[model samples]
Target: MVRGKTEVRRIENAASRQVTFSKRRNGLLKKAYELSVLCDAEVALIVFSSRGKLWEFSSSSRKLLGETLGTCSAAELHELGNQLEESLRQIRKRKQCILAEQIAELREKEKSLLKENKLLHEKFKGGNMLHLNAAEVQSMEVNTQLMIGRPGTL
Candidate 1:
């Protein structure tokens, strides 16, 4: 079956646009990888999405990505595994540090709020409330008129 050429234009729909971008980007990256492997050429491709997200493919980084390992011996693979584990450990440590800092900040905020609440509770507990008599309540009857627009006009 013959295929018609797709028109080169920005997809109007946001979801369709993102989908097309993702598919095309993957295809391009795969082709770059194929070219590098098949021709024994060093290939480096970098793509910046509309939202400033980055997609990159480098032959040098294939080992880090675990893409190519045909030439890697047992020792080399073991070293690569160790390197990956170390990288993961560092990442987890940094994540824990940030989480700890955030937890400490939240605890401090909770303490401050609790202190403020206790002060407010003590102030209200001492009791400064109105205790009006029957005569006073009759004298100060509430007006329940609903007003709208300019005061006198409405």
Candidate 2:
């Protein structure tokens, strides 16, 4: 007969919990060992128990971990650094190009505004002179009427 799947919840009994922990821990360590041996891989596993016990597995000697990492060639590191520097240079160049384009556009706008302002100023100046001439003529008429003894009929 097919058995039903077990629900994976906490085992409330202390003895049952400890037994489960021991079984699972041994199984995990065995898997780790098999994986390292079968695949010829560098593996590290660490487990902690409810009583604060530490268990660990490593495919290689503990001291060899640092040595393995330190085996990278200086030339490789230098090449990586050069690649990063080139990327930064390219980014800066692109930014400068964009800024230069913006500056050119702003200069064009400034020139257009200056030309429009000059034209408006010239138009206003011509109109202002006509207004001033009309004011002068009115003033002269008022003076001449006063000289002839006429007061309010200008």
Candidate 3:
């Protein structure tokens, strides 16, 4: 019997809807997998049924597991190794650049903090404890004790 094109609408029967969803979801996932493999393209598919059941399919390389190595030539293996090395080099370069930027930022902060500490030290001079422009007492031998702590510490 030839099946005619059915109207696209919600299935009235819950059981029929569930069965249809199951069949169609499997078909779509299989198609996606086939497409990814045949085209060497990435495919990701997700399906949620009426009962909130979830099904997902994702396609990525499995060469890391040595599953597809039997089909590779020596040249292919060497090429793969070179690709991995290049990827590692790129990753290391990026990491080093980011670390350099962070170090530079931290050094700038340290410089600013040091400058502030110097200004604070100037505010509490050890000898006079108060700064005046071109003014001095006749007796400069008397001394007092003052306790000071570094910034960001007790």
The positional error of residue 102 in candidate 1, measured at the CA in angstroms, is 0.9
| Candidate 3 ranges with C-alpha deviation above 4 Å | 1-60, 65-67, 126-154
* lDDT, residue 138, model 1: 79
Q: Which of candidates 1 and 3 is the stronger one according to lDDT?
A: 1
Candidate 2, residue 31: the lDDT equals 97
How accurate locally, in lDDT, is each candidate? 0.84, 0.77, 0.79
lDDT for each residue of candidate 1 in 17-73, tens digit (9 for 90 to 100) = 999999999999999999999999977676889999988898765776667788899
Alpha-carbon shift of residue 88 in model 3 (angstroms): 0.6
Query: What's the lDDT for residue 72 in model 2?
Result: 54
Candidate 2: where are CA atoms >4 Å away? 1-3, 61-154
User: Which pairs of residues have clashing backbones in candidate 2?
Assistant: none
Model 2: residue 9 alpha-carbon error in angstroms: 1.8
Model 2 over residues 97-146: C-alpha lDDT tens digits? 98998799999999999999999988978767435666575675333523
1-154 in candidate 3: lDDT tens per residue?
A: 9999999876999889989988999999999999999999977665767668878887885453345878888998888788768877997999799899879999999999999999889777865557644445544556665447866565
Q: Please name the candidate that would achieve the greatest lDDT relative to the true structure.
A: 1
How does candidate 1 score on lDDT?
Answer: 0.84
RMSD of each: 12.9, 26.8, 21.2
Candidate 3 least-lDDT 10 residues: 132-141
Superposed Cα deviation of residue 36, candidate 3 (Å): 6.3
Model 2 C-alpha RMSD vs. true structure (Å) is 26.8
